[model samples]
Target: MATSWRTIGFEKNKKLFERAIEGGELGHAYLFSGPEMIGKRTLAVEVANKITNISVPDILMITSAGSESGQTIAIEDIRKIKNFVSIRPYGGAYKFIIIDDAHLMPETSQNSLLKILEEPNASSIIILVTACPEALLPTITSRCQEIQFFPHPRTIMESVLAEAKLSKANKEFLADFADGRLGLVKRIIEEDSFGEIEGAVKKIMYLAKADINERLDAAQKLTDEKNKAGLPRLVLYWMLYLRTRLSEPKAQKMLSGLLALNEIVNKPQYNHRLALENFLISL
Candidate 1:
């Protein structure tokens, strides 16, 4: 039988799980921290499945409201689990609550959750998983057994790409741009759209040389396709790339423009297209 804590390509974590099983030192509250898509949630859920004696598919996966909702574990969802936690385990040794992207929880929610962590029910185990653990409350962090997950070895990443049946060129591209993130790699493999963003980046750079009208046109095109939330990130990366390519004075100007653009993009009332157009024109 496949164990719930068995994580793919996580040899070190697997050993840790084995040791926990051997020593009977299973924790009631665990904080699993790692880069996005490095399998922190996967491992957490696997452990939860094991403790609950439930099939992985039967595990209730709840999330927040947004495009990234599937990944955002919300506080309302957490509250729903409180009653469940109060009860005894249904079929297994414990009832497990795996909170993915726990850092996304609001301060109010975290405070609400602190009470549960402070005095957890005997049969309940809370597992908080996040890429940005620093965003979580220190009090919450103090109450949990922390586990760190690192990126898989390059060899392991290469093997995973190979198994996905990607061409050599695409595999190299994914490996270079994935930032040690398996979720990013999986996205590239599934959508085959990674290069589209690069093309958009190139267009933005090209616009810097064109007239204001051309720049505005390019900005509108890029923002329309990528959305307001994503445009600043692309511009930020482009600015970093330009800094390396241009003279010091030119780079400084571009960096300042980027900072200004960032400020505009962050404003709730700013029109994304207009802000992007102004930034592109200034560039």
Candidate 2:
């Protein structure tokens, strides 16, 4: 496979980076934001690989996965970036650092990251890859150049489906659910009925009918081990639902609250479970 963003329908983004790189105009910080299962991280790695093709030991790949399960990146992890940047780059090339799930950095971690952003070393290049750019602080975002990605067009998505071995209905299910997320389409093909996303739709009716106590109980259940990564899907579904119902007087408030709660959930410093409980009660 070709090792470039163009490999994943991100030709424009690849060109943008290429121009900056060839012109020697690359910025100190970059924010790569896009929908989940898209190629944000893939492109970041491609950029790094292109620049540091030969022997290089300074690149750092950080993910919230290193933290305790279900928790965001801690202040301690941010310190690694601080320490990593203090050293000058080897052979005068940039010291590349990519932080996947950038939104998972708690407030304290972000503040710590801000210090590095404010006083960026000319030898360092930081790339923050995230699906939720809004979860990051404005000060942090303002310091970085942004590259946005979107889903592939309908024609492109349909073309991909043409190669699948699925039955007509199964193919349609992947088409509707993946909605141009190529990564998601691959996942659905591999996991089928075990895809957690299928469960997000089943909760809308339960959420609507449940009382405060029932909702609170539901919130507790949602925080269990199984739902670790599915929370984003749930939030996205509610946000979309709330947007369509904005004409309803109460829906506006609900939307605002949900948005605020979503931000809190990104920062592990907050009591995310309580936030979910409060959000359910308000609903």
lDDT of each: 0.68, 0.77
Residue lDDT tens for model 2, 97-210 = 899889888788899999999998888899999888988999999999998989877677778888988888877766655656776676667766434554554575467568
Which ranges in model 2 have alpha carbons more than 4 Å from their true place?
Answer: 1-6, 54-56, 86-92, 190-195, 210-212, 224-230, 234-264, 269-271, 278-283
Which ten-residue region of model 1 has the weakest summed lDDT?
63-72
Q: Residue 193 of model 2: what lDDT?
A: 45
Alpha carbon lDDT of residue 22, candidate 1?
62
lDDT of 1 by residue, 32-128 (tens): 8976677777777766666566744334454444324232345577677677676666676677777776776767678878988988877777888
Q: How accurate is candidate 2 locally (lDDT)?
A: 0.77
lDDT measured at residue 97 in model 2 versus the true structure, 0 to 100 = 89
TM-score of 1: 0.71
Steric clash pairs (candidate 1): none
